[model samples]
Target chain A: MLELVSQMFSYGFLNRALLVGTLVALCAALLGVSLVLKRYSMIGDGLSHVGFGALSVAMAMQLAPLAVAAPVVVLAAFLLLRISENSRIKGDAAIALIASSSLAIGVIVTSLTSGMNTDVYGYLFGSILAMGAGDVAASVVLSAAVLVLFVLFYNKIFAITFDEAFAQATGVNARGYNLLIALLTAVTIVVGMRIMGAMLISSLIIFPALTAMRVCRSFKGVVITSALVSVVCFFCGMVASFAFSTPAGASIVVANLSAFLLFALVGALRGKLPG
Target chain B: MALISCKGVSLRYENRLAVEDASFEIEAGDYVCIVGENGSGKSTLLKGLLGLKSPDAGSISYGDGLEQRMIGYLPQQTVVQKDFPASVYEVVLSGCLNRRGMRPFYSPAERQIAGRNIERLSIGGLRKKSYRDLSGGQQQRVLLARALCATEKLLLLDEPVTGLDPVVTAELYALIRQLNREGVTVVMVSHDIVCAVHNAGKILHMGTGVLFYGRAEDYPDSEVGRRFLGGDHHA
Candidate 1:
């Protein structure tokens, strides 16, 4: 076990994957608390599906994946917001409409190519070995930007998420902050989908936030605890992946799930949760 | 001059007239209560006053040193909004966001304002508690504290005591009365005409238009007031 662990660490690919994985995990957790509280958690899922569709098209057209997928996902997030705001279709229904359509487009593109690229499959379910040096750098830069933006507008975002109408009444631009959150979610979703898989990245966003909420009562407490839990979960999941040869994304999700269950039990025993 | 004035103001929901040709004046330090039936455009008029929505025909203007920053608002909370996962402290501090301007972090003066409001509302102990875990009464108190932190002059409350029990409602009304006595101008929308008339200096009753806008004591003799609050005087 020790030999295998050291060998995994010796490889540069594994080290880069862990670094980017931890960064993306932290960003997702920070943004997740706000998104989950605002009932916008599914935006992550929808954006990931859109990212997948864009990536598949990028692959088919022989374009750089991140360059193509990032802008496309951001645009999709904006479109989703507009549809939910202007039309009769509400948030979740609009997400479903966009997500399923994008997923279908991805599937159709993959089949049309008739060459099921292993690399594309890796993105579908996440592959640690598939993260190149460029993917690591791009992910780190974009994820760091997301983290910085969240911190800069932390209080404003809290105000918007907790009570948007009141926030607007008090001269805070709720729509602008909401749009910023949407953009950040889009960025996090695209970057995370590359490593966490399009199918399961939302668990990374949702699980840590929820687990922290079970125990932490305050928003600040929840955010701080969620960041801690997400980083630790990423580390443990990577270790598990190395040890047990499980998939990285699934392993991390399982780690987060275990943490949530443990916190739920502890919260129940402590009577922290109200009936 | 009136702190806020609405002249022939009207509001619409999806191009259909909801509030038509309504006009009223909120003078400085006056507690004005607006009462009406369920869909009587009381809230829509309040929204017009707050500039949350644009008036279709008339102009609503602010005066007597009330600008965008000088007005505080407490919106009616829906079920989902009530379950928001914020602390009393965080929620209160956010009221000072208008004063924050372009600063990324909250200044110490804002913190002082939040602390003062928290102490004023007697929610100091619950400052760190989750907003969702508090009782409905406690949540309203926190929200009031938040509104207090926003502005020292005018407060606009929309059905602020909608779901609270009778005892809590009384307490909230008493708190509002104290603020009004301290010279904080107030404008509120309510279904509880009885209690609203009891505390408010003036009453604005609307059905389709400006039914009655006069002193609370004179509302009983007015034609619209007679139809609305005929026998029931207290809530």
Candidate 2:
């Protein structure tokens, strides 16, 4: 197993894929802690659907999917933020509207543009095995932007997550920060689509955060633990995919779920035992 | 000096008026309690005062040059899902975000302020505990501590004692009164009219709108106050 892992890492394509995946995993996990704490896990799901729709449209137009998907998904996220701010429609409802509509639109567009792209399966289920230098570069730039923004607005974002109204009362500009969060999530989803695909991206955002929460006592601890978990899961899943000839994206998600369930079971058993 | 003034403030949600033509003035250093029924627009009034909601046809203004951070607020204790993992200290420190500058890191001064507020509220021991794990009273205290971390001038509370026991309620009220005595202007909404009469110097009797705003002594004799306060002589 170690030999196989070493050989995979020695290859140029595999090396680039691992580097890109590690960067994205770290970025997603850090932001995922805030998303999970704010109870907006569904926003990740909604944004991924928007990314998928953009990808289908891009495919038909012969444009780069990531470039097309990034702006479109970010715009959709801004609209979701606006609509949810109306006080009439709650956050989850707004996300549901976006997710369902985008998914429907994407499926229709994909079917209409058939025969043009025979290898479109790579975009759907993901194919780290087929990653190129271009994909690696894009992922690195996007992850760095996300990381910088996260650091710049950590305190305000934390305040907004705990109690939005209170945050506003304290002069945090809650709406502005909320819109920023939505846009960041949108960008992360677009970048992450190449690794996890739209169908499985939300799991990448949620599982690591949930596992971290079970053991971490502070918000900073949760962020660190989640990023570590995502790194471990990505590496293990990548190697496992190589060894077993399985899909990379699906393997990563399975690894994440396995880690999540293991932590949950340990927590439960510890709870049952006498202190 | 009147720090906050509302003139014929009527807040409406779509077609329904939450608060109709409410006029009142909150003087500096005054402890005012607002008492009303469930749908009496108590929370709505507080929101209007905080600029969270715009009044349909009225004017509201804060004292000139009063820093926005000087107005602290303690919303009702919401039952956040147990899955939330924020610690009490983290929650309280968030109130200092505005004062922490636009930088990513908290300054030592901001940390000192948060620490002082926690110590003042007497919840320093629970700083590391999860917010959701705290009892209702403890949660309220933590929120109050957070509010205090913002400023010491004006505090607004919305139904702060809803789910706590009488003992805990009394303790919280005592703390509020103590803060008021220390020169912090307080505007609080409460369903307990009796408690309001005992603790608050001024009472705003609200039922749909501003029914009466005056000293508690003056309110107990008014017709609107008589109806809401059970027409009792001591009310």
Candidate 3:
């Protein structure tokens, strides 16, 4: 394991992967707590699909992928918010509508232009080697911004998530905070899609929070535990992927799943113990 | 002086007229209960008072130094909140978010206020407990503590006692009554006309509009109030 760690860090792409992956994991886990509790977990999945479509369009246009995908996915996130808030369309239905349509558009765009090339394949399933130095810098800055914004608005986020109406009544701007959450989620999704792929980026957002909720009783506890769980699982998964030559994203998800199962077992046993 | 005055206010929910041409005034230190049958716009009117919903017609004015943000609100639990993973302290502390304005974190003074409200409600022992772990009555008390942290003057509650048992309901009403006696203005929405008449100083009976608005003492004499209270008597 020590030899593998040394060898993994020796590779520049692996180092970039680890750096960006860990930061994205932290951001996803933090936002995931609110998203899961609000029952908007699928928004991550929907927005990732939107990110994929944007990425595909950017590739076909020969434009900067990150710049193109980021704004488009953010716009889609706002559109999802608007649809959920205004119309008869429920949140889940709206997510499904946008997600499926984006996926369809991405598939058509890829088939029409890219011809199922390795670049498209890399994006479809994720490739750690796909990240460049510029990509790493972008991810780092965006992740830091997400972290700062999250920390700054922690109380407002909690107030809105816990009770939106009550928050609004107290002049907390619940709608604005909700929009902030969506914006952060969109940014996280776009940042994560490069490493985790559109198909699996949302798992990074969801699994850690669910795993933490199994054992943590309070919101702060859940958030802290989720962040730790996400970082550790991502690290372990990255190591395993290096050792076994497996896919990094899938390996991370597997690590998270194992942690979730272990925590669930502990939670169940704790529930049965006499006080 | 009136803390809140609604003059010919009408509110729409989902583009349908849920409340029509409702007019009432809530005086400072008043204990007002808006009572009506299901779908009678009691909760809608409460929303209007809290500024959560604007009047589609007419206006709601706040006076006597009252502002929308200064109004404490205790909304009925939503499905998401039932299983929310938050400590009682965290939930109560969030009430100070409005006053926090632009500051990222809670000030020490805000924390003190949360602690005071928790102690005021006698839930200091449960401050560290997760809100989802509390009993229904205890949850209500935690939320009440949260509301108290928001404002010292006015509280707007929407069907606060809906899920609690009879004993817990009585206890909550008594708690609110005690607060009102201590000069905290309360405007609660409840279907229990008996409890409303018993606790509130004023009652606003509604059936898609303001059927009656006056002193609680006169409510029993009023036709709408008499019918509602008499219906509850047999119920």
Candidate 4:
């Protein structure tokens, strides 16, 4: 196993995949903290579908999928945010609407071009083994952008996530921060879809945050712990996938779930046991 | 001049008029309590005052240069799920976020202000505790502390004591009266007529309109008061 791991690391493709996957995991974990806290975990699910729909349409038109997917996903996210604020519809219902409709649309569009592209299945379930230099570069850039934005707006975003009305009353534009959050989620979905796939991306956004919340006391603690757990999970998953030739995205999600189950057991035992 | 005045104010949802042509004036430093049954527009009036809802045919004028920051509000105690996982300090500190603008970081001064407000409200010990894990009375106190962080004057409370025990309710009312004595204007909406009559100097009896707007002492004999309080003249 050690020989296999050393040999994998020696390969440039494996090195690049590991780097990109780790960065994406960290960024997603940071955003995931707020997403989970705000009870908008479903937004990641919906936006991933939106990304998939965009990819299908782009494939039909012979365009770069990311170029098509990014803007469409962002616009869908913006609309979802606006609709959620309308007072007529509940927030969770709005997310449900976006999620179901986008997934249906993606399926229909992909079916329409089924015979044209044989590579569509890889997009649906991810193909990290096929990740090239360009994909790695794109992943790095998108992750860096997400990291910088989170750093710059950490306090404001924290305020919005906790109590939007209070944030607004104090003079922070809660609406603007909310919209920015949706945009960030969209970007994350589009970038992460290549590694986790559209179907399994929400787990990548949820599990680490859940693990962090189980063990951490403060918001900053959650963020740091979540990022650490995500990086560790990504590397373990990558190594498992390489050794057993398993699916990369599924492996990562399974690794995260395993960590979550371990943490949950510990937490339950701690609750029952005397200090 | 009144600090806030509403003239011919009316609000409706669909074809039903929630408040019909209600008119009143509230001066600074006045402790006005609005008493009414559910659906009598007590909350609607507060919303109108906060500009959350626009009256169909009324004008509301604020005192000159009174920024929104001058008004503090404690909304009704909502039953948040127990798994929300936010600390009492984090929730209270959100009040300072408004004053901090869109800046990415909280200044030491802002943190100090939030800390002071939490300490002043006597929830300083619970600052690190999860908001969801706190009892109902404790949650109300934390929310009140958050509102205080926004402003030192012009407090507005909407059904602020719904689920609390009577002891906690009385203590909260005492806190409000103490703050009012310090020159913080207060307007509260409550369904507890007995408590309202005792605490409020000015009473606004609202039922589909401005039935009576005067001192609490004058309410027992008023026609609208009779209709609302059951006309028995008993405690």
Candidate 5:
């Protein structure tokens, strides 16, 4: 088992996947707590679809996928937030509208240009070999920035998440912080989409937070637990994917599912115990 | 000078004029209860006073060393807060975010204020407890402490006791009264005119406009106040 683990990391592509995947999972988990609690969990899913559309455009235009996709997804995120806030469209409906439209655009663009090539398949379903050294470098830096920003604005984020109206009343820039959250989620989604796939990236954003919530009670507790859980699940999933020849993204999701169920059981048992 | 003064204020909510031509002033240490029937624009007027919404045709100004952002607000409970994962301390500390400016963290002074409010509200025992796990009454206290951390000058409460039991409701009212006695001006939106009359020194009744705004002692003599107060008795 130890030899198998060491051998898996020996491959440069696998090493890069591990490095980038772990960082992406960490960023996803931190933002997931806020997104899930805010009922904006679908924003991650929506942004991933937008990321898919941008990736198709980038592939067609022969531009760097991350460069094109990142900005495009961020803009789509801002538009999604604006549409939800300004129009009569509810948040979930707005997400659906943008997601379906972007997804259709991605399919059409792919069909017109790449015509369902292997690179497109990798983008849609994710591939372990997709990360180049440059992608890895970008993911690392972007993930670090996400982490730092989250920490720096932790209290304000908590203020808004818990009570946005009260936060606004107290002079916090609730709208600005909300936009910041959307922007960060967009960046995280774009970076994670390479390994987790556009289809599966949001799970990286959602599952760890939900799982942590089953056992943890406080926001700080849930956040810290989510970060740890995400990293651990990614590592185990990667190991399992290498060991059993399963897809990395699916394996990670399954690992998160197991953790969620396990934590739920533990929570139930704790509820039965006397104080 | 009035801490908050409104003149010919009209607020449009959901593309309709919810509050129209409303005029009032809240003096320092005044305990004002805003009472009205459903959709009468009491909440809308409160939002306007908080500067969350702009008046379409009037001016709302803050005076006597009060800034719009410095006013403590305890808004109605939101669905998002029902299952939110937050510690009591964290929620209370967030009240200080308005004073935090560009700092990345809570200052020691901010922490001290949160601690003091926690003690003030007597929720120190639950400081580390998860906010979601707290009961309705305890949650109200925690939020009140949070509001107190925002300012010593004023508090605006929106239906602060809507769902609690009668006992908890009375306790909350008493707590608010105590805060008012300590010189924190309060503007509360209430459906219970009886409780409002009991606790507030002033009443501002709304019915698409300022139906009545004056001293509580004189409320029974005012035409709108007599009707509302008599209606409360019948209900």
Candidate 6:
């Protein structure tokens, strides 16, 4: 295991995967806390589906997949919010509608294009080859932007998440914060899809957040814990995948799932103990 | 001058009217309770005063230095709010967001206000406790502390006590009453007409019309108030 681990880090592709994976894990986890509390966590899934469809189209058009997918996914997120608010469909239902349609579009487009892209399997599942040098640089910049914005608006975000109506009443501009959340979630989902695969990216957004909640009693604690847990889980899962020849994305999700179960048990045990 | 005055206000949720042609005045330092049955627009009227909802027909004017963001608001019970992941201190300090403007962090003055409010509400011990795990009364106290951090001039509470045992309800009422006595002008919405009559200096009864709006003592003697309260005066 030590030999395999040491050899794995020697490959530049594996090194890039670890770098972007850790960055995205941190970004997704930070945004996940707010999205989960707002009951908008599924937006990650919906946006990932939108991103998959956009990526397929971008590939077909011979364009940069990330460049095309980011804006389209962001727009889809805002559209989802509007549809949920202004139409008869609620948030979850809107997500399902858009997500399913985008998934179908991605599949249909992928089949029609029939491009000799070897990375389709990687895109569908997960692959260490997903992270190239350009992708790593872009991921770093995007992840840093997410972190800076989150810190800058931390107080406003807390105010809106707790009680949007109250926040708006107190001149907090609830709509603006909601938009910020949507934008950040959209960007994180798009970036995370590269490493986690479109099918499994939302787990990165969700698992760390829910897991952190079991042990964390405050918003700040949950955010910090989630960031740390997500990065650590990504590394562990990636290492395990290399050792066991398993799918990278699934391995990471399984790692997150195990951590969640462990924390839940700990939380339950703590609950049973007398204060 | 009155702190706030509403003239022929009509508030709506979509096309349905929540408050219709309502008119009233709240003077500085007044402890007003809006009493009404469900769907009678007590909440809507409060929203109109807080500038959340626009009056379709009338105008709401502010005086005595009241602005849209300066007033503290305690919203009614919501399942989403109850499940929020925050400490008691975080929740209380969030009330200072209005004063924060476009700044990124809370100022020392805001933090001091939050600290004082927590002490004032006697929830200093629960400052680090998770908000969701708290009992109903304790949660209300935390929210009350949050509202206090927002404003000392005026506080608006929508159904401040919806569910709680008799003891907790009485305790919350005492805390709110004490705050009012300390000169924080309060406008609360409650279904408990008895407490509204008991604790409030003025009663704003909202219904199909502006049924009664005056001193608490005058409500029972008024024709509409007697019909609305069903002649029950038990406190």
- Candidate 4 vs candidate 6: the DockQ winner is 6
- Provide the lDDT at B189 for model 4: 93
Q: Which ten contiguous residues of candidate 6 chain A have the minimum total lDDT? A: A115-124
lDDT per residue as tens, model 1, A205-270: 999999998888788989999999999999889889988889999999999999999998988888
lDDT by residue (tens digit), candidate 6, B1-235: 8899888888897688988888788998899999888888887788888888778898999889888788999998676777777899999999998887899999899989999999998889998999999999999999888888888789999888888899999999999889999999999998999888999999988884688889999988988778777776433
Supply DockQ values for each candidate.
Answer: 0.71, 0.63, 0.87, 0.42, 0.88, 0.81
Which window of 10 residues has the lowest lDDT sum in candidate 4 chain B? B76-85
List the candidate 2 regions with Cα displacement exceeding 4 Å: A90-97, A116-118, A270-275, B79-82, B232-235
lDDT of 4 by residue, A1-275 (tens): 89988988998877887887888888889889988887778788878877887887888788888889999999988987777667777877878777778767767777787643546676777777646788778878888888999999987877677666556556677778888888888887788887778888888889999998886766777788899999999999989999999988999999999999888887788768774
The Cα error of candidate 1 at residue B50, in Å, is 1.5
After superposing candidate 5, which stretches have Cα over 4 Å from the reference? B231-235
In order, the candidates keep a fraction of the true contacts of 0.70, 0.68, 0.94, 0.40, 0.95, 0.81
The alpha-carbon lDDT assigned to residue B204 of candidate 6 equals: 86
Q: Model 6 misses residue A164 by how many Å?
A: 1.5
lDDT tens string, model 5, A1-275?
A: 89999999799999999999999999999999999998888889999999999999998999999999999999988988787676576878878988989889988999998798888888877889999999999999999999999999998998898999999987888999999999999999999999989899999999999999988988899999999999999999999999999988889989999998999999899989996
Candidate 2 chain A least-lDDT 10 residues = A114-123
Scored by CA lDDT, what does every candidate get? 0.87, 0.83, 0.90, 0.81, 0.92, 0.87
lDDT of predicted model 2 = 0.83
Q: Score residue A259 of candidate 3 by CA lDDT.
A: 93
The pairs that clash in candidate 6 are: none
Q: List the candidate 6 regions with Cα displacement exceeding 4 Å.
A: A1-3, A86-88, A115-118, B232-235
lDDT of 4 at B138: 87
* True-vs-predicted CA distance for residue B169, candidate 3, Å: 0.9
- Between candidates 1 and 2, the one scoring higher on lDDT is 1
